[model samples]
Target: MVVGLTGGIGSGKTTVAKLFKNFDTVAVYIADIEAKKLMNSSNVIRTKLIKEFGKETYQDNQLNRPYLANVVFNDKEKLHVLNSIVHPEVRKHFQEFVQLHIKKAYIIYESAILFESNSQQQFNFVISVYVDLEERIKRILERDNSTKQEVLNRINNQWKEDKKLLLSNYVINNYSLQETSNSVENIHNILTQKACSIL
Candidate 1:
């Protein structure tokens, strides 16, 4: 079974994913890890990014994220162009990962833009993690080392929890790590039971 976990910036989806890692499940973080690999490994992607954003977008053959961030984060069209380049590459990588993990009873792919990009349709289940907006902003400030305005700008780009919740098979409101673990376990239990029934 393929499950998806997603949330807007600073919603603790990664924390829930880490909890799932402790289980006998294979979990893939598409946005953070896979995106990094695709940017580094694919010369085509690297060239396109450089052409779109210029040579300063890379340093030592690596993505100069801060330079790119300043470009895309402020310009919606630039960010969309970057996503257009990166998302397809990441999706291909995800498909390959899922194929290789077919033996696993359950597998998870986490992406922040799962719903926004209409990617959740590929998963058997979608889990949306959320937190109070105020709390989420606070967490983003600390985590990303960004000012309030910067964090808010990023948050503004994402779909709100209310919308995501309507589509998600499961919704987790992240308040604390312990609570988040409990929520994941609840979903895990349900998934396990469903898998058993299918057998």
Candidate 2:
């Protein structure tokens, strides 16, 4: 089974995903990591990005993430264009990753914009990780060393918790490590039982 995990910016989705790591399921981080790899390795991606956003998008043979972020986050059209380039590559990578892990009982593909990209339809189940907005903002500020408004801008770009919650099979409220870990363990147990029943 494939599970698509998602949450808003600063919502502790990474923390929740880490908790699931102990289950030995394949976890794919669809945005930051995979997208960076695609940008660095794929000449097609590089050329398209330059054509769409201009040559200033790269530096020293690497994507200038901050520069592109500044441009895309402020311009909705440019952000969509960026996502258009990255999501297809990520999805292809994810399909191959899943094929290699077919023996595993479950695999998780985690993306910040799963819903926005309409990729949830591709998964057997969906988990939405959430944290209080104030806590999320605080974590983002500390983790990213970003200004308050900058953090808020990123948050504003993501789907609200309530909206994602409505569409998810599971909602994991991640406040403390113990709470999040326990939630993952419980979900793992539920998945195992369901899989066993199917067998």
Candidate 3:
């Protein structure tokens, strides 16, 4: 089974994913991390990104993430184009990863754009992490060294919090670290049991 764990920028989904890693029965795939790697390592992605965004797309053969983010986050169409170039390769890689981890009770595919990119169907269960807007903004500002407007522009590109919660099979409220950790444990137990059941 694959569980799609997703949330908007700065919603602490990565923290929840790390908590899930404590369980022997669970394996986690972080899509954004892999996508970044692929963008740098895969020739196809590199070629397309350069074709679309020019030589500035890479510096010394590594993806210039900040330059790309600046271009796409402020332009919705450009962001879609960027995702189009990257997401499919990530999806293909994920399927191969799933085959390798077939024995695990379940896998968590944590993606920032799982819903926005129409990827929820690939998972048997989907979990949405929720943190208040201000908290999310603060977290992003602290960690990303980005301006409020830049962060807000990225946030605006995604589906709203309520929409994600409504579409998700499960929701993790991630305001407090202790409480969120407890929630991850509980959800992990539930998912493991479900994955193990004969029915």
Every candidate's CA RMSD: 1.4, 1.4, 1.0
The 0-to-1 C-alpha lDDT of every candidate, in the order given, reads 0.84, 0.84, 0.92
> How many clashing pairs per prediction, in order?
0, 0, 0
The best candidate in terms of lDDT: 3
Which parts of model 1 have CA positions greater than 4 angstroms off? none
- Residues 1-199 of candidate 1 have per-residue lDDT tens digits of 8888999888888888888888875555557678988898998899899899999989998899889888887888888899999999888887788788777667888888888788888888999998889999888888777889888778887888899999999999889788888988999989877666766
Better structure of 2 and 3 per lDDT: 3
Q: What is the TM-score of each predicted model, taking all chains together?
A: 0.94, 0.95, 0.97
Query: Model 3 over residues 1-199: C-alpha lDDT tens digits?
Result: 8899999999999999999988888889999999989998899999999999999989987899889988998888999999999999999999999999999999999999999999888788999999999999999999987889988998999999999999998999998899999999889889988998833
lDDT of 1 at 174: 89
Error of 3 at 97 (Å): 0.7
Residues 18-125 of candidate 2 have per-residue lDDT tens digits of: 777767744545556787898889988899999998989999988998899999888778889999998788778778888888877788788889999998999888
What 10-residue stretch in candidate 3 is worst by lDDT? 190-199
